[model samples]
Target: MNTPLLELQGLSVHYGSLRALGSIDLVVYPGELVTLLGSNGAGKSTTLRAISALVPAHGQILWRGGSLAGVPAHRLLKLGIGHCPEGRRVLSRQSVVENLMLGAYLRRDTAAIHTDLERCYGLFPRLAERRSQLAGALSGGEQQMLAIARALMGRPELLLLDEPDLGLAPKLVGEVMGALAQLHCEGLTLLLVEQNAEAVLEIADRGYVLEAGQLTLQGPAQELLANPSLRAAYLGG
Candidate 1:
């Protein structure tokens, strides 16, 4: 068997005195699309933050078997870990292309960066059309597209996405999810944190459910989708 691309062993996180993640264990193998599902305040976002080194954490986080302790948030990108955070954190004032350029700021290889930029444009033609417009001016769906594209500029081996479909209309949600499915089919490894169990289970190979800072359930997508408890809680009673 091959080594997992990422793993969290006994992962724990705290916000002052509050425990946000409690001894969590999870894994994502190379080229697989895995999802972490939970309701709001279930610590879904905190798990991603911890993995990205955005906040202080405890326990062992291994990327390709190397420790992530003491690794700062900014350096994770260079290590092939790219985070497309929740709430579409694209620079509100910057042009779409400018935002993408920021994603590639640390790279010395200009040619590859340019190539990746074109690839991003290819993945999202709307972005190409609004390439010169302020990112905030685009519609919500477009902003989400730009967010994904910017992260792609990093050319990551593992991409962590939080709430990719939050607050979008049903149609826009399908569009964003479709884009993610396309990327996953193209062999990108992803760890997706989402509340829409129905949407992610369709694309993810496996999933883990978190509840109030603890992992509650995990299994292959099909099993999770059909799980009575999961269906009742996330799908619709």
Candidate 2:
């Protein structure tokens, strides 16, 4: 087995008196796509936030066997971790290209940045078509694509994506999911948090289920997809 690229042990988070995440342990290996599935408010986003250091979390987050404690949120991208947060939080006023440029703000390699910019355009042709348009003017699906492309601009080793497919039509959902699958096939390690369990499970190597901030079930994607209870609760079977 390969050494894990990322690991979480007893990770927990609190928002004032409320615990947003109970202790949860999960692992993702290099070049693998792992999905974290749950309904709304299940701490799926919290998990990704904790890893990105967006929220104060307790316990361990190990990256390539090194402890991530005390690592500041802003530095995570420089450390080869990219986070595409929920809500497609693109700068509404900025042009699409400008938003993507901001994603590589920490990097000095101008040539490579340009290359990655073109790559992102390739990944989302619609983004290429609207490269000069204001991010806010794009449709929901287009904004989601921009958000993912912005994250990819960081050239991360492990990408943490939260709800990339939320609130879109079925056709848009399929388009977004297909892009993710392509990225995974190209060997990008992804830790995705999504409520669309069936779509994600189809591309995931493994999945962990979070229920009200605690893990309730976890296994290979195929097994989880095949489980009757999971099908009923999450897969809409």
- Candidates in order have lDDT scores of 0.94, 0.94
What would the per-residue lDDT of candidate 1 be over residues 58-117, giving only the tens digit for each residue?
A: 899999999988989988988899999998988999999999999888888988998999
Looking at model 1, which ten-residue stretch has the lowest summed lDDT?
1-10
Those runs of model 2 whose alpha carbons end farther than 4 Å from true positions after fitting are: none
TM-score, structure 1 vs. true: 0.97
What is the model-wide C-alpha lDDT for candidate 1?
Answer: 0.94
What are the per-residue Cα lDDT tens digits for candidate 2 across 13-117? Answer: 999999999999999999999999999999999999899988999999999999999999988888889999999999999999999999888889999999999
For model 1, the superposed segments whose C-alpha errors exceed 4 Å read: none
lDDT of 1 at 50: 94
Pairs of residues at least 3 apart in sequence or in different chains that clash in candidate 1:
none
